[model samples]
Target: MARVSQEHLDARRRQILDGAAVCFARNGFHATSMQDVLKEVDLSAGAVYRYFSGKDALIAAIVGEVLDQVHEGFEEGARSTPPPPPDALLASVLSRVLATKESVTVDGRPAFPRLIVQVWTETLRNDELAAVLREGYGVVQRTWARIVEAYQDAGMMRPDVTPDHVARTMMASAMGFLAQQALFGPAPVEVLRDGLRGLMSVPDRGAGSQSG
Candidate 1:
């Protein structure tokens, strides 16, 4: 048999991942069967197994892809010239996330939010998946932390707040907002902006205050 080229292999893998993402999102990790995935990709069981050993492996890949997309969004936000101000950086990150929500569709359905929830729940029950999810979330938190630290160092943030604290708070707020929007409907961007500003804001410490 003629050997399949690397390019062909990668393309096939991407197709499988895309199909698996849609299935996992709609039926969820626990509810979804290998056959459901097979139906999505129109591939044989053996063909699907070639890319992913089983449902767990496929779910892991789908979650990893979602994390990668989020990372890309942050990278795009960071690349803005002169870098965005603290407020702009937060907004930019949120905007990128929203943009991804709008753009990523599968089988005439929006799957990202569902996929995210599935990954979160599954992570609690599965150690390997939990580790991957934790690592991915850590990367996101670190990215925001670095941005917060830069602003703090530059005197843009109130000196009383630590970068790690601000970063964690901001991420928590963003995740909550995302959950609300996914469960309800789209929220006003201004509401998110205000919430983030409030979390990152520092009260003015008078010049006479001792510099810790």
Candidate 2:
């Protein structure tokens, strides 16, 4: 038998992952069986199992892949000259996320956001998945903290608040937006940008009083 090229093997693995993502997104994790994934990819059980041990393994890989993208986006921004302001940085990431999810949507509903929400719920019972998520998000958060520190140094953000705290809060806001988008229909990305701008515009009462 001719040896399978590494490129071909990688492509097959990607196919399995993409198919599993769609199935899990269309139907909840519990509802999507391994057979459903095999059917979606039109691959035999042996072929699919060779890539992922089972549904849980697929779920973990899918979630890790998505989170890794998000982490990379933040890392990229940090490398830019004067890195994007917080709002623009976040808006860019959100736009990419929406577009990617929209590409694999089912019945006009984006699969990626839905799958994200499902993963959050799944983490409640699955300690292993929860650990994976925590570590992934933790790295993203650290990157954001570094960005926050830069903002503080440039006087764009207040220096009083801890960078980690600001980063975590920003992450929470972003997650809330995703949950809202998933539960309801899609909203313009402007909504998120405007909201962040409005928050940034708010005066710091402590600073105002001390300066008076």
Runs of candidate 2 exceeding 4 Å displacement: 205-207, 210-212
Local distance difference test scores for all models:
0.73, 0.86
Q: Against the hidden true structure, what lDDT does model 1 obtain?
A: 0.73
Off by over 4 Å in 1: 1-8, 75-82, 97-109, 186-191, 194-212
| TM-score of candidate 1 to 2 decimals | 0.77
Task: Report the number of backbone clashes for model 1.
Answer: 0
Determine which window of 10 residues in candidate 1 has minimal summed lDDT. 77-86
Question: Candidate 2's residue-wise lDDT over 131-210, tens digit each?
Answer: 99999999999999999888877787778889999899879878999898789977877898889989888877777567
lDDT of 1 by residue, 1-212 (tens): 99999999998898888777777877778888989889988999998898899988887787787678767766665555335665556566677666655544555556666666777778789999999988998997787667666666666666776778877876777677767765765666568787657755756567568676
TM-score of every candidate: 0.77, 0.91
- Model 2 scores a TM of 0.91
Which residue pairs in candidate 2 collide? none
